[model samples]
Structures are given as C-alpha cells and as structure tokens.
Target: MRARHGGPAFRRLILEDPACGFDARDARVTHNNPNEEHGRLLEACAAGDHGALQTLYRLEGARLLGVVQRIVQDRALAEDIIHDAFVNIWTKAHTFDAERGSGKTWIFSVARHLALNHVRRQYREVTVDDTTAEQLDAERSLTASAEIEDTFDWQGRGDLDRCLKALEPERRNCLFHAYVDGYSHSEIAERLDRPLGTVKAWIKRSLQSLRECLS
Candidate 1:
C-alpha cells in the first residue's frame, strides 16, 4: 500500500534530514520508554489527533530512516520512503490491531515494507549470493509475531552477526528475502528457483537456528 501525500508542514516534519532537526537520542532524553507509548499514541492518531502523529514522528522518525537507508542505500530516496512510511502510518493508523503486534512494530513494518518495495522495483534481479546480508537487527521489531516478530537485542548476543554470517548464503538469502525484502514463501521460491516447500522449510530451519544461536 502506498502513502498519500501529506500537507507541507507534515512533509517538512518528515522529509527533512534527521541531522537538521530530530535525533533519536534527543527523543530518548525526555521519553525513557518510547516504545511503551506507541500503542496509546497510535490510537490517538487513529482518533484524528495530528499532535499524536507528530509525537510518533519525533520518537521514531530518525530510527525509521536508518532502517530504510540501510536497505535502499540512498540518503534522499530513503528519506522519501520514510516520508511515505509516516504518511501511511498516519493514514492507516486505524487499521492497526494491538493484538497483532506492538505499535512500534506496526509503524516500523510500514516503513520497512515501503523500502523493500522500492528495492524490489529497482533491483529485483540482484542476487544475494556470497554477499553478507544486512543485519537481522534491521528486522528485530517484526520478528516478535509468529509469522514475523522478535526482539532485536543484538548487543545482548555478541555473536549474533557471526551466527547470521555462519548460515549458508542460499539459506541466508531466503531469510532476507522473506523478512527483509518482505517476500512471501511462494514468491521467494519462484525467485530463487527452489520448490515452495523447500523455501518454507529453509526459512523455518534458518529461524530456528538463529534462535538457538542467540539462546
């Protein structure tokens, strides 16, 4: 789903570089536990409170840009994707179900998906052979739910990056295609020229191995 264009003020609030204004560290100074506030604030946004949406931008805009930039690897394009992401978050806030995942996860998922969509459209043929995949911490928020949702405390596990690197390139490619690129099992199978069942099993086993390594 694409985000509709927002007004000028909202556009400036999001599209401007984080270095020029918003900083995650500054947001944390006043809000010690920002994630905890996301659900309530998102509900407020759903109720048509622009201020609540701004608060969310202040809390997550920079980090969300980081997530997008890492994937798209373009500063200006990442900012554009982040702008679209927040617009989607504002417009789609009402659809969020707290039961499905945390509000932070929902918003990040919105941004992440937009970035992935951009990558797929621009770089669909690029293969992830021996290239080290982007860190899975980029997807930590989405991993907590069964299909995709888990914590991203990479610092807690010193070897998390090593563990990811240890996985076979094809297997790691499958995980990134599924999680980072937001591709479905069937789509991944078709893209990678593997059977659907094999793609599904590889994702499952790869996830289990990562969890075990982290444990």
Candidate 2:
C-alpha cells in the first residue's frame, strides 16, 4: 500500500522497511529514543547515506511542510521550500553539532529559514523599484549601525533581559529584530525567515511572556 502524507501508513512504511537502509540496530535505537534516533540519522546523512536522509524526511516532512505552508501561505511555494530545505539539510548534515542543540530543532530551523527567505524575497520584489530599493537598503545600513550602538548602550541587564531569556530562541530573536532593529512585521519576518503572521504573533506573545515573567 502507498503511504499517505503524515499518515500512520507512511510512518509504518519507513519504520518497517530494512531496505530503507537503516539496519535492525538503527531501528531499535530509533524506536527507543527520539533524540538519539535523529542524531544518528543526521550522522548517517553526513556519511552520504541517502536512505538515512529519506528516513528523516519520512519522519518530519509533513510537519515541515505544514510549518512552511503556514508562513508562505502558498502550497506550491511551501513544497518548493521544503524540497530546498531537505537539500540544505543533506548538504549541511556534516555541520550538525549535537553539543549545540537537538537535531530536530536544527532541521526545523533550516526549513523555517527557507520559507521565511522565500517570502521576504517576494515581498521586496513587488514593494519597490530598483532605485527606491537601493535607497532603502542604504538607509537600512545606516539605521542598523546606529541601532547597534543603542543596543549595547541600553544594556539589557535588567528584568527585561531575564524575561526575554524566558522566550524560545526564535521568539526572542523576533523581538530583537522588531524592537531593536526597528523592523516592520514583514521585515522582521524576512529577517527571521518566519511567516509574517508567525513573526507578528511571536512578537506579541513574546511581549506578553516577558511581562508575565517580569511581573
């Protein structure tokens, strides 16, 4: 039977097939611990094991596509981004460092950034002509330079910093890009490679989370 997207059948197909090139030992490990499974799969991918990469895709492809689709709001574009994301994961698999973070998080971040970048590029294309865009780029550089100074001088050593630390890294990054960098929602979305709506929600929820944390 053909596996359906995100369906149990798909998972069974991946998990049950030794021909997928994940041996019996790998299957046992995968069944026992999720993080370890992902880490091992990534290592295998780094070693040029295409089957390992396929296994990873079968495990996470649906969710990754969902995440990208939500951000880009276009199924075709999201699918393209997912394809690119997997290509990136395959190419950059050697760069995966378990000491720094989980493989799952790294994978998701790669896909998320791809989706965000695609939308941001599209936004820039329709929003301005070449001359005006160039002017804006120059202005942004100057503004960024000034903001760098301001960010250091302000010193986020207060409760705010502590509170901000309570947020997920992605959400925290969104806040900094929006408030410190003076980026609009679309700009922040572009910068963070998140969906515009997701960026907005992140900023809003981050603010709320910070307030609660401080209070």
Candidate 3:
C-alpha cells in the first residue's frame, strides 16, 4: 500500500525498510498487469517455483500488512492475517484467472477479504451486554470492505491522502470507526455522543468529499 504512513514499525525498525524485501513499489510494478503476472506467478508457484512465491511475499508482505493492519488493528492479528494470506495464496494460486483482474490485485484481494471476513465472522459470534464490551465487539467487526477500498496508502494509488487529510480528526474517526472499527451509525453516535443523523452525515459527506477529491 502507500506505505504505512508513519506507523511505528516503519520508523523504528531498520528491518522494515522498503528495500529489505518489503517495497510497495515492487508490488506496484507487478500490479501493473496483475492478472497476467498473477497467472505466470501462480503457474510458476504451482509448478514449484519457490522463488516466485518468495518474490510475491517479499514484494507484497508489508503492503498487505499495511492494508490488513488498517482493518485488523492489532499487530499480532494483522500479522496473523499476513501469515494466513501467504498460506491462502499458495494453496489457492491454482484457481486464479486473468479475466477477473490482475493477479497482484487478486493476491491482495484474497488476503484482505479473508482478513476482513475473519474479523467480521468472529464479531457476530460474541455477546454484547456491556457498552465497553459492545464497543470492543463493534471494533472487531470493523474490517476491509468487500472491495479493496481507496482508503489507505496504496503505492502509486490515486491521490487520496490529501482528501482524507482534509477531514477533521473526529470526522475521520467515523470513517475509521466504520472501516477500521466496524461501528454502525447508531453505534458511532452512541460512542461520540452526537446525534445519529450528524454522524451519518459526516460519514456520507466524508466519503463524497474523498471521492470528489480523488476524482
């Protein structure tokens, strides 16, 4: 993705530098014709090109981490998603197709969807009597949208940072609450102590503003 945008991991760890097998640019290069290369890589992987799989992992691991990190939040859980993503990519590479989208996109789509689904499915199974627990529950449910949204930093992604940044921090909070924290409008109103209508307006308008700015 567009880099971690200054997460502690990006700054503090020397090992996390994009050059050390975690470059978003490298991922973007393959993403140029993802479906075509995805097929090649998949075929190679299926045919036992361990190096190809490793290339995929090195190129996308951090970006995928950045994407999944936004939704899953917990460092450990985000890492867990990455772990699962690699396994999933390896096993499901055989099923990939160029007609769907670029292979690189599919790789990320598969990884992110699984991570989002993981949190969403788990969120539905919990009890919710206390407000604290309920918020926690709601937070867990906040995950990746079904599509790979233009929300976070995607390498060479459409210009969205300035738009997302134009919003007030609290207004932005609603976006994260829905996309990252998985809270509903009513839940967000309750949490923020504003009118539900106001919260809803903020989210809708925020999205509109973002789309306009990007467009």
Candidate 4:
C-alpha cells in the first residue's frame, strides 16, 4: 500500500503507519495475500463508503453464512453471529493491514472466528448420549448437505479435491465435520457412530492424500 496519510501511500505501508500503529509483519501475512486491494477497501471503509463494505459483504456473505451455519446448526443463531461479524468488520475496517492478510481472508476469518467462539463457548461441554448423537448427526448431516454446498467445490486448488474424491461419500464426513461443522475428532466419531479410530484414520489419510496429490 502507498498513501502518505491516506491514499496509495497508505496502501504501501498503512499497517506500519504510526496512526494505524500495527505491525507490517503481523503473523497473518504468512497465510494469505496481503495485497493493495485490501488497502483500497479499508480506505474506502474508513471514508464511510458503505458501498465498499456492501460490495465485500455481497461477495462473501453467502459463503460466510454457509460456514457459520454449518457450525452453529441453528438458523437464528447463525444469523445473529453473522450480524455480529459484520459489525466487527465495520468497526475494525481501519485496523486492517495489507501487510498482514488479504482483505477477503480477513473478512472470512472474522466471521468464522465469531461463529467458532460462540459454539465453543456455549456448547463446549454439552455431551449428548451415543445413540442420540448418531441419529441427530445423521439428520443434521443430511439436511445440511442436501441444501448447502459446504465443501467449496474448491476449483483449481490442485489435489485437495482429487484426494477428497478418493474417499467414500460417507467417509468424507470426517473432513466435513472438522472444516464445516467445526466438530472435534471425538465429536465426529460420536456423530458418525464410527469408532474414534476409524474417524481418525479417515482424516489422517485424507490429509495425506491431499498433500501428496497437491505435491
């Protein structure tokens, strides 16, 4: 980023500017593209260009909701979480650092972490019995999969999809549970009624297959 106080100079180093006062080397930079478009969006946001935020919301809102809904498992609750996520996005827009992460990634991370935090905090210790867990899991999985495209079909990311294709539809539940439903390994086991060992194997092998395929 490049704005002196606020413009393209800000684009070149807004993350490092004293007024912004954040690090140019914040850790998220390692994970995604920290390009100038993010800087432009942040600038637009700071200038009260609501249209900029709306455009971002339009681009990301459906997928973000899909992700959040998968985790929270309640429509009203997920909507509430999305609402909070947008509020956070608006308030924190000025704090975004192009050197830290891509604006798109940053936006998704905010929404995802909010959903994760809510479910983690509220339902962390609630243990359903084995039989009911399995039934509810089946019903929820079917309902969710039927109506939603949760796994991102992930075009052009290389071997991730190819590896995913290797697994049986049901076995893919392991990845879906973690990536989409935010379930832990134990939760996946309980929900799938597969032994914990089996679920663990599926996920381990699935990741291995993905890595090798990508390689």
**Which has the greatest lDDT?**
1
TM-score ranking from best candidate downward = 4, 1, 2, 3
Off by over 4 Å in 1: 1-33, 126-204, 208-215
Error of 1 at 173 (Å): 8.6
lDDT of 1 by residue, 1-215 (tens): 22223346544665344467543442322465566689878898899987778888887888998888766666767888887898899899999988887899899999998877776774444444211332322253234233322222233434567788667677777876666545666577677656555666678889999998888
Instruction: Find the 10 residues in a row with the least total lDDT in model 2.
Output: 145-154
Best by TM-score: 4
lDDT (tens digit, per residue) of candidate 4 on 135-162: 5456444444333233435446643666
Give per-model TM-scores: 0.54, 0.51, 0.50, 0.56
What is the alpha-carbon lDDT of model 2 when measured against the actual structure?
0.67
In order, how many clashes per candidate? Answer: 7, 1, 7, 10
Worst 10 residues of 4 by lDDT: 1-10
Looking at model 1, report the run of 10 residues with the lowest lDDT sum: 129-138
TM-score of 3: 0.50
- Which pairs of residues collide in model 2? 116-193
Against the reference, the lDDT scores of all candidates come to 0.69, 0.67, 0.66, 0.66
Per-residue alpha-carbon lDDT of model 3 for 125-177, expressed as tens digits? 33334445445545433541232233433234435667877786677777777
- The lDDT of model 1 is 0.69
State the number of backbone clashes in model 4: 10
